[model samples]
Target: MNNIVEAKGLVKSYGDFKALNDIDLTIPSGAISGLIGPNGAGKTTALKSLIGLCDVEGELQVAGRDPRTSRHKLMEDVCFIADVGM
Candidate 1:
């Protein structure tokens, strides 16, 4: 089994507050995954970082390409949907 998404030592910060602290994650290919947490728990931050919607620290790989470096290319294969009425 190979990982379709991989994050190692992932960190996201806003000012002095850390939205995400050293997050390490791996999702196997063809696996269904979900992120569940309370408000301000870095769920959005993590998703944004994975899709290159925001700048992030540490390493992130999606489909064998770095999200930070190949965002345009990555976006070609990735889709994001948000609840506008939420």
Candidate 2:
């Protein structure tokens, strides 16, 4: 199955602390996936990175588009649970 979200070698750091390291993720369309780990395990960081909430390093894409460069375009097809939707 093709993936709606994909990340390769995803890395996020705060100063000297590394929140995400060498992370690889793939979430296919119409599939439910969960991120699980101990506290400060980078789940939030990864999710934010994918949704273009924050800038991080490494290759990341959403729906076959680059989130870093095409965030607005990608967001059009994405929905956040907490946001008002129509």
Candidate 3:
């Protein structure tokens, strides 16, 4: 099975704070998955990085395209819905 989403050695930082540290993930096609964690656990950061909403280090690919370089094209195939606050 090929991965629909793949990340290796993923890292995301904000100034002096590290939101994500060395995250490695893979989601096979047609598989269901979810991310669960307490607040500030880097869950949001990871999602943001996957979709190219934030800058990230290491290798990341979604649907066979690099998120960092093909963000707009990637968006055509993927959709992201962040939490809404009132």
Best candidate according to lDDT? 3
> In model 3, what are the clashing residue pairs, if there are any?
none
Q: Model 2, range 1-86, lDDT digits (tens) per residue?
A: 88998899988899999999998888999998888899898878888888788788888989998888999998899975532331
lDDT of 3: 0.90
Off by over 4 Å in 2: 82-86
What TM-score, computed on C-alpha atoms, does each candidate reach? 0.92, 0.88, 0.92
Please report how far candidate 2 places residue 21 from its true position, in Å.
Answer: 0.4
The per-prediction CA RMSD against the true structure, in angstroms, equals 1.8, 3.3, 1.7
Candidate 2 local lDDT, residue 30? 95
- Model 3 misplaced stretches (Cα beyond 4 Å): none
Return the number of clashes found in candidate 3.
0
lDDT of 1 by residue, 1-86 (tens): 98999999988899999999999999999998999999999998898888888788888999888988999998888877865521
For candidate 2, list the clashing residue pairs, or say none: none
**So what's the TM-score on candidate 2?**
0.88
